[model samples]
Target chain A: MSIPQQLILTFISGGIICVIAQLLIDLTRLTPARILVLYVSLGVLIFAVGAFEPMQKIFGAGVSVPLIGFGANIAKGVREAVDKDGLIGVLTGGLTSSAAGITSALLFGLFASFLFKTKSKRM
Target chain B: MDSKAKKQLIKKHSPSTTILKNSIMAFIFGGGICVIGQLLSELYSYFGCDEKTCGILVTVTLIFIAALLTGLGIFDKIARHAGAGTLVPVTGFSNAVVSQAMDAKSEGYVMGVGAKIYTVAGPVILYGLLSGVIYGLIYYIYRTVEQMI
Candidate 1:
């Protein structure tokens, strides 16, 4: 797709994600943990069934922008590993690939936590 | 089953904290897990394993470390320190499974290990499945239109 198309897709996708996440918080009893996992897993499963292919093709970043994109990456990594390692890839492919994102998030989170004082509920 | 038993469990896990600490912890804990992964990958290659084998080690190592932390009760402490951070790792993933299992100790091993463990993340799994289906259908329809155009 064209650059313009890609940008538009990303904007829409990101907007949709934020909107849905907010709605879930306002409407459902589900915790944030459940929602984050849901978004990631939804991305993976959608990509696995070849459902996200069109979006990915049209708006590569758009599909990849949301947390779902990370999932797709995980699925892709696992599939790639399967060809090389067969049975073993089934176990480890996702972790090795997603490790960076997880780590980055963690590092950034820790740094942010250190810099800012988070309120303690009990206190 | 009794309030005393429930209180016992809470004591075992750390008490809840504020959202700020939770997010802060989320970042650190998640970051820590990632560092562990890097370390594991290095170890894998250090032992002369191929990329495939290293990949397998990555997951195993992450899960094992997480399980160990959970068993040691460090996971609960970390969770208290960085709420979502702890939940975001492979280890965090293990904690989610085991913590619920701990809650269901009265249900016996099979039910506790198999059924009850998923109680915490079940809704997330269900929602993810539903969203994936919805997103796929939407993406497919739009793609067909683009192809025709």
Candidate 2:
């Protein structure tokens, strides 16, 4: 696909995903935390059904920028590990694939904590 | 007034959320973030990295930026208007960890920053990993069975 087309699809997919979550927040009692959990798990389920790759092929980063992509990444890691190492892959694959994300979040979070103070929300 | 009458009175006076406006904001900001990711991926690919590497690089770069924004106290302000546009992306995950760590700073580093860092994002990691493992187990068994047949 052309670069412009890819970016447009990414934006639409990402926007639609967020809109769905926004509607859930405004229309229901589900907290943001719960919605995050739901989206991530949904990603894993989509991967499990073998639909994640095809959807991603079309949606590009739109499907990836959201937490669901993270969930699918974990599942993808597990599949690769299981293929390579049998039972142990189930134990190590998820973390192995997600290690980059988890570690970056941790290191950056720590650095930010030292460099800046939390500000109270301004209304 | 009776209890039901009081409830009705309160409900009548309470302001309702403008759902349409919030949805439009979410669409713009959320989609904009993804476009940024796409651009970053394209930049990385232009530098000769393959698709997979570009994906990882884009994620890392975005997380770093999100952490910086959270530290600068800007993420939450944008989130106020963007709503799930910010919350639904990987950047939100970074903000969750950084914001919690910043809040717990008063409690000291180990008990405060270290332990509290994952308070919000913990469930995401925990459940994501659990589901991945479960899926792996099922996939393994299915593959093995198919091979035997």
Candidate 3:
């Protein structure tokens, strides 16, 4: 609730979330890409079950900044759209919900490509 | 001693990895990034945007910053230290795609940048959208049932 308390909670939650991913990377053969997808899908599932909102409320960016938060945002958007538009919402809701983030990434990414020369990673 | 046994002994005696130090670094760096996001959110709200729109603006700005960093090749250096700290944020997702596109630019244009753009992030987008549709259907059913009851 207070500023200091909020900071502490965000730090702990953010660290713990990263730790889980780090452990998965260190302990298993799962590639980072797979783990990332898993995180997103798991977030959506958690959100659907009505559990993610409380975590988001308490942790703030601790929960919201993570990829799971992104997934949850999509689900939240779809739910709102479905309420308003029915079956059609099911198809468009996710994209509409995250359109801002996705579109910005695409446009900025393309802009960066033109501005900066690519360097191959040394093998 | 045989070379294998000697190598094993050296590994056993090697100093343990500094998990605490790494975690502390991640916490600090990751928290710093999130704090930036929070500040942006506050700034947007102050500029008269509603809460939802403010969040969108913050996210768009972060994605832009992250993509720029990835293009400049600094994000990789930071990632080596920050690890999942950077990867956990939406910026990380932008970094993933942009870095891939940057790397593939060498091979050619279409098959290179355009095709490989989604290689790493493709699964995330696929699964994320899939989950959204699934959740939407379930929520729709629940709402319908609740109204009937």
Candidate 4:
């Protein structure tokens, strides 16, 4: 696909995924936290079925930007690890692959907490 | 009014959500975030990083920006309107961690910030890792069986 086309697909796919989450939020009692957990697990299950790659290929960051993509990444990491290191990869691969994202979030989050105070939501 | 009638009255009077409008906002905001990610990935790729490195960099950059916004109190403001638009992306994950930490800063570092930082996002990480392990084991067995056969 062309650059513009790929970007458009990314936008559409990302938008659609968020829309589904919105619908869940609006229509159901599921909290945002639960929904996020669900999405991540859904990503893992989708990958388990061997479908996440093609979806990523088409949607690009749309599929990859969500927590679902994170789940899939962990699964992917484990798979690769298992292949290369035998059974030990089952325990080591997921965190190993996701270390960059997880570590960055933790470091940046801690820094932000020091630099800024929380504001009460404006009623 | 009787209890049943009071319940009916309360349910009737409560303000209803603007579902259509919220969905539209979510789509726009969520899609916009992804577009930004795509652009960032492209930029990194142009700088000669491999695809995997670019993906990692894009996530790191997004998380950093999200953490900043959450700290500045801007992300929640936007999230008020964006709803799941803000909540569904990786940015939302960053917000969860940063917001929780900031909220608990009053209780000091270890007992407060440390304990509470993952209160919200812990499930995502925990379940994410759990499912990955489960799937990995399954995949390993399947592959092994395939090879044996």
Chain A of candidate 4 compared with the true chain A, TM-score: 0.95
Q: Worst 10-residue stretch by lDDT in candidate 4 chain A?
A: A114-123
How high is the TM-score of chain A in each model?
0.80, 0.96, 0.93, 0.95
Q: Where does candidate 3 clash, by residue pair?
A: none
- The sequence of per-residue lDDT tens digits that candidate 2 reaches over residues A1-123 is 999999989999999999999999998958999988888898899999999999889988899889999999999999999999998999999999888889999999999888998777889
Candidate 3 wrongly placed segments (more than 4 Å): A2-4, A120-123, B1-18
Q: Enumerate residue pairs that collide in model 4.
A: none
DockQ (0 to 1) for model 2: 0.88
lDDT of all predictions: 0.54, 0.92, 0.80, 0.91
After superposition, the stretches of candidate 1 with alpha carbons farther than 4 Å from their true spots are A1-30, A42-70, A77-123, B1-22, B121-149
Mark the regions of model 4 whose C-alpha exceeds 4 Å error after superposition. Answer: B1-7
DockQ of each: 0.07, 0.88, 0.59, 0.86
TM-score pick, better of 2 and 3: 2
**lDDT (Cα, tens digit) per residue for candidate 4, span B1-149:** 79999999998999878999999999999999999999998899999999899989999999999999898889989999899998999999999998888888899999888889898778989999999999989988998999999
| Model 3: per-residue Cα lDDT over B40-84, one tens digit each | 766787899997887788788888889988887788889888877
In CAPRI terms, model 2 is classed as high
Runs with alpha carbons beyond 4 Å of true place in candidate 2: B1-10
lDDT of 4 by residue, A1-123 (tens): 987999999999999999999999988968999999999899989988999999998888999998888888999899999999988899998999889888888888788878998777886
lDDT of 1: 0.54
Query: Between candidates 2 and 3, which one is better according to lDDT?
Result: 2
- Candidates 3 and 4: which is better by DockQ? 4
RMSD to the hidden true structure, all candidates: 13.1, 1.4, 3.5, 1.4
